[model samples]
Target chain A: MASPLTATPRVTSVTGASQTIPAAAGIGLRAEHYHALLQTRPAIGWLEVHSENYFGEGSLPLTWLERLREHYPLSLHGVGLSLGSVDPLDLEHLRQLKQLIERVQPALVSEHAAWCSVDGRHLHDLLPLPYTEEALNHLVNRIQQAQDFLGRPLLIENLSSYVQYTHSTMPEWEFMPELARRSGCRLLLDINNVYVSAVNHHFDARQYLAAIPAALVDEVHLAGHTRRVIDGVPFLIDTHDQRVSDEVWALYRFAMPRLASVPVLIEWDAALPALEVLLSEAEHAQSIMESDHAVTA
Target chain B: MLSLPELQRQFASAIVDAHAAAQHESLWHDTLLNPGRLTAYRNNFRINIEDALAAIYPVVRRLVGDEFFAAMTRIYAGHAPSRSGNIHHFGAHLPEFLRGFAPTRPLPYLPDVARLELAYHQAFHAGAGAPLSDVQQQRIAAGGYADLMFTMQPALRLLRSDYPALRIWLANRADSDEVPTIDLNAGGDRLLIYRHLDEVEITRLDEPHYRLLALLAAGHRVGTLLNAVSGPSAISRVIQFGLQRQLFSELMIIENTP
Candidate 1:
């Protein structure tokens, strides 16, 4: 692994004025909204897509994304990189991601801070990592390797989890900031994830937010989750299938001061609504950021 | 203290079988509630694969009811676990799995249907192809036929099955208004599936035509391709059809001495 002391080179060859995403709200681009987004070109700050969706050879998704790039600054949020996995890094996956990054020239790139595959088998769902020194060391090394491979700083997001490791020696909030500091990467603080995991594991969400160093957070994510009552105990499932819930929105409101003007994304993966709904949700987030920014100013 | 790889291995096993999770339950906080959380993860994994399968194989889902399809996918997931992080690449082995699966054995044609769906899925994502330019077409027209080779579009997929798979596929299309009653003993299928614009177009081909196209795709020269046809008129007709459809992307003339 490259030494964390060495400065990781930033992505060069970045061309044009829209190369950087504005400090405003964007929506996760789903296949359902591709055509509508192209024809209508909704008013959102930017658009974010799951990088794996376009991993294949040229298709409708790639064609539309190239056209969409002209209108909106894009962010590549990866779900399959499995940066926290103990398994050997899938070099082919990294190569394709790099190719895409070069092709699209997205303003920002990010992945989950959780592992989703093991031993050549991918579970296809984000799984929580034990918050131990060993796991932290492993993740820091992997992040450094990934950053070196991509030639850009990767923004790692906090995942929503249902279970916590009993053997954990540190809290996740502490582990994350430390990881960012050591790896020379940044954080994509997912506010909805914090809320969901808090409800599931009985942690204080406010405290979790307070612990993270503000400067490390480069982006924020807000998504809806499903709540199920199991044996009279409520468990929140981070299923991005609905609108941002009242509680998650409130958490976003609270974290606004810490996050300041970071690029916020509203994600609705499953049970996708109409394009207008996503646009309006993003508009709502933009309003919040505007109001907060105005107050700060 | 479980190592990171050891924990991940155990976690993966626990996802499929709760019994395996029991041994590693101590690794998680709230052992009593860990099993429930594992179940959620398992459901998400199953749902992700099933959804990917459903997207690629919609006609199969239509032929077999949703409940039956879901059950089959659950079992199939266990047999061929996904190796790629992208779910779109998950169901490549579904056609082979259908061939060996016991419950679906009664429907011998099911495997071909699955293959057709896979082909459609592939063609949908295949790279865009450009038709040959007029100058290139003129070069082919000026052909010294023996040394000329033809290349087909990357989006082309040829499939042959002893069952009427294409008919079944067309009849089962979601927007297909009239359910054509196809005879079980109707005939076998020699199919040419290719993407045109954004949609996949499927057409039937006669034995000789299919063989000729297959040979061309396999890098046979035009002289050899012509020998497969019975006569000059027939070869001319085939060549005309090929040119009209823009079937071949490039035509090259090789030197005889080489």
Candidate 2:
């Protein structure tokens, strides 16, 4: 039987063509930095926001988003889709997302490869998925349904996990690309997540990056992680509160050669710093991307 | 081997229920997983929801200090696990939760404060709509005012509380350095919370105006509201106030009865 992802042709919007984000570097547009971002209009490639933040009918966030959209391309990154849940999908959530897509017409729309809810209860944290065929099949179906509903393709990002399921048959690196292939979705590979999960689960970060086919990757996310000792065991937490660590920067450098021309985003959600700090981070990523482009060219 | 659903069910249980973690320890890939690692996921779950609640109800957190607020939210989460994926919608039941909570009994006004905060939060995110146009205003001026039905803006939230919740909220603002001592006996407040342009505005409404606006917000026709309230002039003044504040998004002229 043909997979729905492959069988169904990609749907384009009837209203108009959506803007495409440049294959450069961008930063997450947070509420704290709205005024600074609007006034400065920093030379970043694009801005990404949590889709749920603007899901309200009308608000300051939506108003600011519209203003920012005029200055830069936008990407709607969703955290609440719970794409891997066993329960039926939240059509209302999907409908709101579609409405946002129409209003903002963001260049790229993305959601996590993990689920945040099960049994109709939302944990609101991106929980890890077991790397098994059954889990893989479920995620693919949900992603296809979401893609069809939005009338656009989605970029599924890898999540940082603290626990590896005993029943998982494959590694996350393999699972991610397979998900993209089967679901007809693109990958928003988060380098920090790869590093965090690799350290937590005892896998080589390079191996995780090596397994991803470059063509499947549409964007990259680099964020900070904190090291904490829990019950005498140390783990890397994807906190996104501080600067991109040296180790993650090294991993991005390693991944950039293969991910040439892929847009990269510097995400800082908690304890957001001044807008200048995020803009500087994006500049650093842009330099790395440009250097890689020079080498490949 | 557990199926995907079974693993998720157990995993969610372990994260939410502290006792369930030990039972689900065997579900992890033992070679790499440890008790501490599983606890990390559990901690993340709690912290994420708590942070969301804290964001939505900062004044509540300020009123009861961080430690108390944290404890309160932990219990609240267990009582009402978030039903929506959007964390913003997670704390809607908090006002009701605060009312029943034992620790907050002494602070009798806490729940009302929470209600005001919730209204402000809702007003901040509610949909925008154009207020009644010049033509509609002209129609109202031409008389037959008692037959008009007004539709409240999506952004408008009318809150009436026995406690001075608005003053309590104002005194506890993060930007306000000096916390003023508020008199608990100062009397209740009837507030009009709505988004004006990009900012959320909260105005204290007088009793007569509050009663009339409250009626209109409840979808009561102007004729019924006039019968309920004293004098046509008071109703007219409140309607004019509502129009000035952009409280009514639309207006409909119903049949005039003798």
Tell me, by lDDT, which candidate is best.
Answer: 2
Chain B alone: TM-score in each candidate? 0.90, 0.94
lDDT of 2 at A76: 91
Pairs of residues at least 3 apart in sequence or in different chains that clash in candidate 2: A58-B127
* Candidate 2 all-Cα RMSD: 6.4
The global C-alpha lDDT for each of the candidates, from Candidate 1 onward, is 0.82, 0.85
Which regions in candidate 2 have their CA more than 4 angstroms from the true location?
Answer: A1-18, A229-234, A293-297, B24-32, B256-258
Which residue window of length 10 is worst by lDDT in model 1 chain A? A1-10
**Each model's DockQ?**
0.35, 0.39
lDDT of 1 by residue, B126-237 (tens): 7545666777677657745556677777778899987899989888989887778878787789988876666778889998888777877887766776656765566556
Per-residue CA lDDT of candidate 2, range A1-297, in tens? 111111223233232323888999999989998899778777789889999999986676887788788788889999999999998999999999998898878989999998888899998989888889999999999999999998889999999988776668898989999999899999999999999988887889988888999999999999999997755656799999999998888888887678868999999999989888998899999889877542211
CAPRI category for model 1 = acceptable
Number of the top-ranking candidate, with TM-score as the measure: 2
Per-candidate TM-score against the hidden true structure: 0.92, 0.94
iRMSD per model?
12.7, 13.2
